[model samples]
Target: MKITVLSDTHMPRMSKEWPAPLLQDIQDSDLIFHAGDWSDISVYEELTSMGKVHGVTGNTDLTMIRGILPEQTIIEAGGKRFGLVHGHHGKGSTEANAIAAFSGEQVDCIIFGHSHIPLLKQDGKCLLFNPGSPTDKRRQPQYSHGVITIDGDIHAEHVFYDSKS
Candidate 1:
């Protein structure tokens, strides 16, 4: 399975449409994960039109978004358990909060977004991934998103680019 992960799009607020470079990845993905802060329902609608999307609602998400999406959830993909969260609920750094979100759960990976910083590392037996904002890179040097491919084993990587246009 091929999964595309992203967060903090803040769409329409960031751009009227998906970034041109990111579009190809999104289109090629078998599944999509949006960690949150979409800011507009159209972003969700558009992603769904392209493929399956599993997402959480961020602290900044509109009420309509919060009403439909959960704050956090776990999904099973390619025989691996993935814990997903927007990472704004607890009293700590976003990374810490995300890890805590599934403290008692048995997840192979924990995916989150809130700070718009791309990170991919191993935390014991689990993988931690944050696919930074393609539209809102913040202090990062480049716009980025993530791709996770699962065959016999799982592998994840960031796709960075210089432009969001």
Candidate 2:
């Protein structure tokens, strides 16, 4: 199953809209995972037009968005367990601490976002991902989104779309 991973989309604030290519990918995906910092619940609703969305609340998300998405969510995708969080618990302050909290949850991967930094890393036995920001591309030049391929070999890729265009 191919999963579309997105994060730090500040909606009307960050970027005007989701990239057309990413939106198309979402429609073609088996599932959609949003890391956090959506800033608005409407963003989730809009994204749902693409596919099934599983997400968490980021630091910038309002109370309502928080009500909808948990601080962390554990779900099964592509025959593997995944833990998705907003990473507001300290910009991934301690990987061990975050993983420890999710240790007994039976997860094979951990997906999180915050700091508007994109990351695709293998931490020990799990894959940790941060999809960066499609809008908040301050730190890095890559205004990006993420794609996770789970059919044969588990893989994570960040697709940096030109924000200017």
How high is the CA lDDT of each candidate model?
A: 0.93, 0.80
Q: What local lDDT score does residue 153 receive in model 2, on the 0 to 100 scale?
A: 62
Q: CA RMSD for every model?
A: 0.8, 2.0
The digit string of per-residue lDDT tens for model 1 on 19-133 reads 7767888878889999999999889988899999999999899999989899999999999999999999899999999999999999999999999999999999999999999
- Give the per-residue lDDT digits (tens) of candidate 2, residues 48-96: 8767899988888999997888888898877888899876674347344
Which stretches in model 1 have alpha-carbon errors above 4 Å? Answer: none
Candidate 1 least-lDDT 10 residues: 13-22
Per-residue lDDT of 115 in model 1: 91
Q: Enumerate residue pairs that collide in model 2.
A: none
For each candidate in turn, the TM-score is 0.98, 0.90
Which structure among the candidates has the greatest TM-score? 1
Q: What is the lDDT of candidate 1?
A: 0.93
